[model samples]
Target: MTDAAPAIAAAGLRKSFGALEATRAVSLAVPPGGRHAIIGPNGAGKTTLFNLLSGALRPDQGQVLLGGVDVTREGPDGRARRGLARSFQRNSLFAEMTVAAALMTASAIADGGSAVFWRRFDRDAARAEAAAAIAARVGLADRLEELSGNLAYGAQRQLEIGLALATRPAVLLLDEPTAGMSPEETRAMQDLLAGLPRAITILVIEHDMDVVFDLAERVTVLDYGAVLLEGTPAEIRSSDLVRRRYLGERTQ
Candidate 1:
């Protein structure tokens, strides 16, 4: 991404499922190298917006631009190939796959080298080395042999982030990485996220106000499927509407 261009730009985004309008003409920008947080209550269309941005779901009307390309119509895989990646609120991993195995498989898929996983990975040592490196980076080296389902829930979540990182994406969309985590686990996740290189942009949908304020350089508050406000952490803290609808009239 260039210094002057936005990493992600959404314009007039709208989505409807049956009778409910999930997103209503919402728009926002995640600046280059920015850690931007999206916060809203339940049913505020937080996940739906992520789906639109990540190409998991198409917007009924609008445009999603990544870097400079208009990618509203791109499917998930196409967007991924164009340097977009995301993790969901639920840990999306092969529950039966070992950490090392899962990372190898992910690296193979994301690298776009081959579909013959067993022949390509088992014969090549570089794939194993790369997968191990990614596993260690996410603090899962110790659990390399553990089945994904057998690991703790927080560990599973960490693995999901690791999988997204394996894609070498320019923008990483995190859909509540800290959701359902214990306080200690959440802090660990926050540290891992903060320690990431500044070259990568992270746009996160987070409900934990503490995490948002601690990690996000900019904050976007969504209420009732629209951008209620957008500002720095301090500005968000002082906003009257944010206080009433999301911040509970007191700083979190």
Candidate 2:
């Protein structure tokens, strides 16, 4: 591996809740501008791991590094300020707000101008332009005027992604972006994600094998809160350990 610092790295990470060990000495590295994925069966601590990386939860042990800086002590807002952003598995949009309004809010927050109540967001040319640009990037330009809650499920998910991009993050953590979707919708989401600018490093936790294979350059399999295996997509597909432990006969 090159000596360049990773965009995100978890070193000997561990976390627990009461007696439950949700993460156990987990470690992984994501190269700058790379597409990496975490996959496993339910209860494999994928979400918990995401929480640690995004600073939603502090690890009991180990360190989280973003762009080579130790951010283990940073909170979610702190991480975001350092160009780390995350999208949840559920729709977290403002249901009553229009897509434009929501995106403007996100852009303003990320730009550290949320306190500028003296000027209307829509009237701010720079913020409005940035919001419109992000909306187009995520394929939500057509729905700009629609109420976020009234959009189709797939559209809602698109909005979620748009919000994440609005932060102009250097590292984005996406959890189950396609959790529930029709085949057509899934394909659309896949295309949208695939088209994202490679300047932004993407780390995704997804259950769909097809999606994982289609999007990730590297795959990390987790089991019982620890990394079971890590390899290229081809290596992961061919590994007997992964097949037997996770992918099953279908991968064979």
By lDDT, who's the top model here?
Answer: 2
Best by TM-score: 2
Q: Could you tell me the lDDT of residue 222 within candidate 2?
A: 95
Candidate 1, clashing residue pairs? none
lDDT of 2 by residue, 117-179 (tens): 414776788877887888898888888888888989998898899988888999999999998
User: For model 1, how does the per-residue alpha-carbon lDDT over 169-225 read when each residue is reduced to its tens digit?
Assistant: 799999889889999899889888887777789999998888899999999888889
Q: lDDT per prediction?
A: 0.83, 0.88
lDDT of 2 at 184: 90
In model 2, the clashing pairs are none
Report model 1's TM-score to 2 decimal places: 0.91
lDDT of 1 at 51: 89
Error of 1 at 86 (Å): 1.1
